[model samples]
Target: MMGWLWAVQVILFAAGTGLGMSDARRKSTEVRLPLWVRMLISLTLTAAAFALWRDDPASSSKEWIFWGMAWSFIGDLSMAGIIPWRHPMIGGMLTFAVAHVFYIAAFAAALHHEGLDLMNAGLAVVAVFYGLVLIAAWLLLIRNPDAPRLFNIGSLVYGLWIGAMASAAAAMAWSLGGALWLTAVGGLLFVVSDTIIGAAAIGGRLLRHQGYWVWLTYVAAQMCIVYAFTL
Candidate 1:
């Protein structure tokens, strides 16, 4: 089952996190570039996703997860400026948004696999709250004088994608319970990380080590989502 890959990922994740936290310490106003260490970690996760999907060749959800992770790897590269693009920042945002679409697909597939309905009173409440919060946050980001109009628009669009991903994961976890809760945790953590970035965009500068907050939560999010599924 390629279980040893988990150990490899763990080692890489720890190393990357340490480097990211160290690099983040001095970045006050600007977000740190997506460094090679982080990109290597992302690539490892993508490979892990593929291994998982290969293990469950019949599972549609696993297939979606693999694609999602692949797109995420591409997004990391785009953000790192390793990929050629006229505007790397916006390209990375849009690419990451596309990855969320695959995650939404994976959640939908998981729901179907579990024979659970996506619509329910409890999940509706959670979904509604997420929607309202996103709306308010989007308005705030767009109105910020410091952020460019294009960046604001991209953030709003990306925020909606992540919101949908979170809602889908929440519905799956709420219905299934148990280890699936990690998936929900991952989704929510992703929102937390992204929200920090958005807040920084609005306020110009965040507390010291802004990248540390963002990177730690984000890595946790990705780890939670992929491993929880195997569990």
Candidate 2:
């Protein structure tokens, strides 16, 4: 039953992503049906994914992951509305922020179980490099004149938290001898998705179709994290 549920979850996510890409293509036409369809499918996918392992072992870690997905689903709903102010992007960010916190906890538990060794020079170097990149990106957002001050500030804080989550995933991967490579990659992709979405929100016209890429990476990131548990 679990295996079948996992398969269905992946299929739903893939279909939703494809529909989201189509929505991006037709967004200029003001037809939002595809976007709504995709959002609904994505929501179902997350729920199904959570149901797959709700009764499995490692209950504590799974509980955190489940809550992470639950928060993500709320974030998705917050982002789905046409009224931006009614469901502000900041609200979505907060929801996802909490979700990331849960994800970090789960990753930490996994790292603990596997025994972490972060004294490696290479891992330190990579972490520092990634930290620098996040700082630069945060500064860019902070300096964008077109964005409202509140948005700029909120985005900076949210970006930092997400970056920390990604760093934790990377550290876990390093400690586990590349065993959690998918989770690490997923974390990076989540950062990329949020960065693009933020840039577009701040009046980056070139990134207008950013939703397609954002959802693609975001959904894949969640799926990767889910798969990592079975590894």
Candidate 3:
């Protein structure tokens, strides 16, 4: 039963990606995916993923990451709905921000289970990278006159939290030499996807060019995270 549920979840996610691609492929047409349909599919897949560890989640770190992935699923659906209505842009960004926070919590919990020290050389490198991201986000906000103040801030907060979470995971020391590396990679991919989305939103870049790149990155990010949880 667990195996079948997992298989179905993957198929659902794959179909979602195919839908996203189809949306991208239809150029010169104002084709947007049905908001409710996507939401329902995403939510159902998430629930199925969670069912794997429903019996004993505390004993399975993979389950914890799946919970975080569920948050991310919700965020992705909200963000996809934002521009179509234009009324929920801020709400969507906030949802995604909260989702990243959940991811941070999951990563931190995994690191704790590994008994990894917070202060380390890898962490220091990530700290420097994180500082650069902050400065870059600040610069983007300062220079962009059309950017919404609140959503821009929300993007920054999301980026910072995700960076910290990825850093923590990367530096963690596991007892058996491997610990949630897939999750860490997934988190990093999500950071890239979100960063691109934020830049496209504020900088007015990538609009004139191809639209598929943006959505592709978004799909890739989500798929990576999903696979991470299953791994």
Highest lDDT scorer: 1
Worst 10 residues of 1 by lDDT: 25-34
Top TM-score model: 1
Per-residue lDDT of model 1, residues 106-201, tens digit only:
877888887877775546877787888887876764347666778777777778778888888898888888898998999999888888777775
> Per-residue alpha-carbon lDDT of model 2 for 22-97, expressed as tens digits?
7657664322235655566556556655764575755566667778888888788777764354537877988899
Better of 1 and 2 by lDDT: 1
Question: What clash count goes with each model?
Answer: 0, 0, 0
Off by over 4 Å in 2: 1-3, 13-33, 82-87, 115-126, 203-205
Candidate-wise lDDT, in order: 0.78, 0.71, 0.57
After the best TM-score superposition of candidate 2, give how far the Cα of residue 39 lies from its true spot, in angstroms.
2.8
Stretches > 4 Å off in candidate 1: 17-34, 139-143
Ranking by TM-score: 1, 2, 3
Q: What lDDT does candidate 1 reach at residue 169?
A: 86
The candidate, 2 or 3, that scores higher on TM-score is: 2
Each candidate: RMSD: 2.9, 3.4, 4.1
